[model samples]
Target chain A: MDTATKPQQIRLSTTPSRADLEALKIGDIVYLDGLIYTAREGVYKKVIEEGADLPLDLPAESAVNFHCSPAATVNPDGSFNMGAVTATASFRFSKWIGPWIERSGARIIIGKGGMTSKDYREHFVPNGAVYLTTVGYGTGALLGRGIKQVKAVHWNKELGLAQAMWVIEAANMGPFIVDGDLAGNSLFERENARIAANLDKVYEGTRPAVLRRFGETDDRTDEVIG
Target chain B: MIAIETIQETAERLMEKAAIEIPEDYLDGLRTMANTEDGDLSSFVLQAMLENYEAAKQDRRAMCGDTGCPRWYVKMGNEARIEGGPIALEAALRRATAKSTNEIPLRPNRVHPLWRTDHDNNVGIGAPEIEYGFEPDGEWIDLVTVHKGGLFGTDYRMLFPSDGVEGIKRFFLDSLVAFGKRGLACQPAIIGIGLGGSKDTCMVLGKRAACLRTVGSRNSDARIAAMEDEFKALGNSIGMGAMGFVGKSMVVDCNIEVGYCHTGGMQMSVHAFCLSSRRAVARIHGDGRVEYRTDPDWFTDYQRRESVEWTPPQSLSKSA
Candidate 1:
């Protein structure tokens, strides 16, 4: 918590500290005070789906990437809660949280759920970025802290909360684990990469789940998984 | 003389009045929690509810547009009499539907999945309730037309890394996981379960469950009441908060509708929102008349320079 002697710089370097990362354990709490970028389904996919580059210039350095699409709320106690759900559907559109974390000059990937990608690790280790986990269903609690403000840019009204860059300021948030880490020996990264390497084999070229019940479409199940 | 009530009249009445909002008791409880929850994240989740209330009021939009599949449940009074209903309730309702659709612009959400999408209409097979009977109670025929909307991202079966609950609890956890993966769009989402009913009935109720309700409200059944409490607490433990980011994200509300099950008919649906969720309901007399509430306050306006954001501009701790 040193403030003046050697203030923690919101580093923008492509590489993070390996020593700082390996020193961490599974449940070790961290208060990351730095530059982080938030994006959800629409913004995440438009990067590749639309074959576009990073929305505002990519900063794959010490930046952090948060995968979330928050709704606005005002608590009775006068606090604010934002980002109260899961980012899986956005994941359905694009699994860019990891890649963007790397490309956005971020060394931190934060959100609920798990990510399994080798490229993510390859990038994470050299850059010293790590994946952190927030509780799976505690979304409402996350937002209850009362949002001070969500500094958002590059918004898509049509996409609503789906595609946008949000700067979230959290309060008293804790215990979000490092699901994936830059130690290069993380469990999350290894499995994700293995899956990605053979996604085409496992899912690609597969027929669409046309005969789904409730008379729904299988447009997503058959999409080209990245 | 068939003095037809112009469809326009019916719609305005419905929008302005008939749509049934969740019971007062439900919202009041949520207000209490939003005010009292000591948990920081708990307060944030509650705030989302406040926003919903404001949005539905000011804009006059369906509080949550999954305004649901409109199911007309009719209860006739013992002395209930028909004036000129030679105009089928279904037809009258259809006319009202068309008017409501245009006015609220409730996204042309309905489409026959089996065929090409056509929302040029609102009535479909067995829609607006062609099925009904006399209650013989003269109970003033309180017509409960409930609208349930789509609240899912993936099927419960589609929840990956199979979880560890069994029986109803398994069902509940599966719902949470499915809700996380599919129900919620990675945002603050309310999960409502239809405990028992026909495939159609449960689905309708399930949608309504998320329509609008005060948090902490419960069913009369002891089992369900307990289940609601457990599901909510357990869900929060999952740390899927507002936008499913992470925190003590509270499920603002979860409603369960139960009816006699008919052959493998149990359904659960989750209507998730990144925040600006809009859903509301009202009631009308058999005459299609209603006494709607006066204009209330509007929701927090969407600033041109602002929108829903998962992360903040500064560390939330700045104020903490």
Candidate 2:
């Protein structure tokens, strides 16, 4: 494998259009600079299921919504003390992602882990959007460094931080990878399949030692996915 | 007698510390991975995490946004008595949890199941799960709090008597391979494998192993210790990096704890904790002295050893 000694620095607009997203291929190391919005769990459900409009006016093409519920402390004066902010697993919010993309015209979805392969093939690819994973480390550190301001907070009292919208301005932020590109490619799905294919051989090599310990039959199927 | 108020204060401090600090051994493991790894992205990510930890410590801020579900493992001294009595300790712990949520500004993650109400305080029915154990003749009450948060699902399993060690290994690897695809289930994850207990016991053991054990610490049983070594090697060999980017270090440690089981069934569980493993420990003396600790010292008795690196095959293919 060719090793990447240094991450390629590509600057992306905070608000990316469909064409902007489609231009970006899988595996492009990017540094996002501009404004991004935080929305997850509650916001997605409310906008898609409860028929509420997206709390912000991010245009579809350049819109970037990170799946995070920032741990921001509200001051007595109603300001926020933005604390540690990081991404959560995206698949749990998979159902609402497509709808949010549709309604809000969001072009990029960034979070930890990744979306399902089906979401990549059907929703992301067709919508001309890409799924990116936050660089796992220093997410909170990035907030401390990259975030210049919390532009606005919406629906603060009713939903609190859990469902509130925080418009944030960031600079030279993100070393995010395109785990799922607009071309129906998924780095996550492909690696999993390759690893699964090799499991039998690995198991076969260790079968004898296992048999010696516990008298087990050879006819066994391993199903990992529920 | 330790006053209930003192216990409450200690519990609150414990929760706050766990939210902010990464344990020493776990931090050491991360630094080792960051320094030794050849992969660029993985190294960068690891270094970034280290930087984040330092920043959080200096700012007195939580290390991560998800300040997780509070899982408390309490050790009660046989001779210990509290001003409000024994049952009051639980109440103190609960109050501490709520107080920390507001004080530390922990994200309110606890949601009511049926009504979909967000308990903005991280408190609800049965919140801040407490598991208690008694230590005879001990002089101080000790508390170890593990804050659990991540996206990967299903942590427990019940094995049939027919399924052997091979089956157990397969389950562990398979679950990993699947979760790895859906996003790195917190890379360089610490996997706690519990074997042979009743289902419930196995689940608890699995959690304890993940939360309480030090990285690179071995099980007391030689066989289980050897298994820990083997699993660590096998897991890293898969080449799943920090965030599924394909690197040499996938699992930092795999701790296995086993218990005797009924003949009818062999129960097992796997609890996976991410590299940002957060926990804290505290001890309160009968004389009102309190000592707060970052290291749980869960594996103090188990010997620590150098990590053995596994080389992947030359023909290894990566997706990225």
lDDT of all predictions: 0.43, 0.72
Could you give candidate 2's per-residue lDDT for residues A1-226 as a string of tens digits? 2554465557788777666677776666777878788788778777777888666675632378888787776777877677777777677787788778777777788887677767877787777778887776436645645677778887767676767777888787766777788777876666555455555655653322222324333332321222
- Give me the runs in candidate 1 sitting further than 4 Å from their true place: A1-92, A95-226, B1-11, B16-26, B36-49, B61-71, B83-87, B114-116, B120-136, B153-166, B181-191, B195-237, B253-289, B292-320
lDDT for each residue of candidate 1 in A30-132, tens digit (9 for 90 to 100): 5444334566555656664676666544453225566654433223564433423222322342345446544566666666544444544556666666766
Q: Which ten residues in a row have the lowest lDDT in candidate 2 chain A?
A: A217-226
**Two-chain DockQ for each candidate model:** 0.04, 0.34
- TM per candidate: 0.48, 0.86
Q: Native-vs-model 1 lDDT?
A: 0.43
CA shift of B50, model 2, Å = 2.5
* Clash pairs, model 2 backbone: A15-A62, A16-A61, A16-A62, A17-A61, A60-A105, A113-B183
lDDT of 2 by residue, B87-189 (tens): 7988888888887887876777887777757767778888878887655445678888888877572356566666677767776765565555544467777
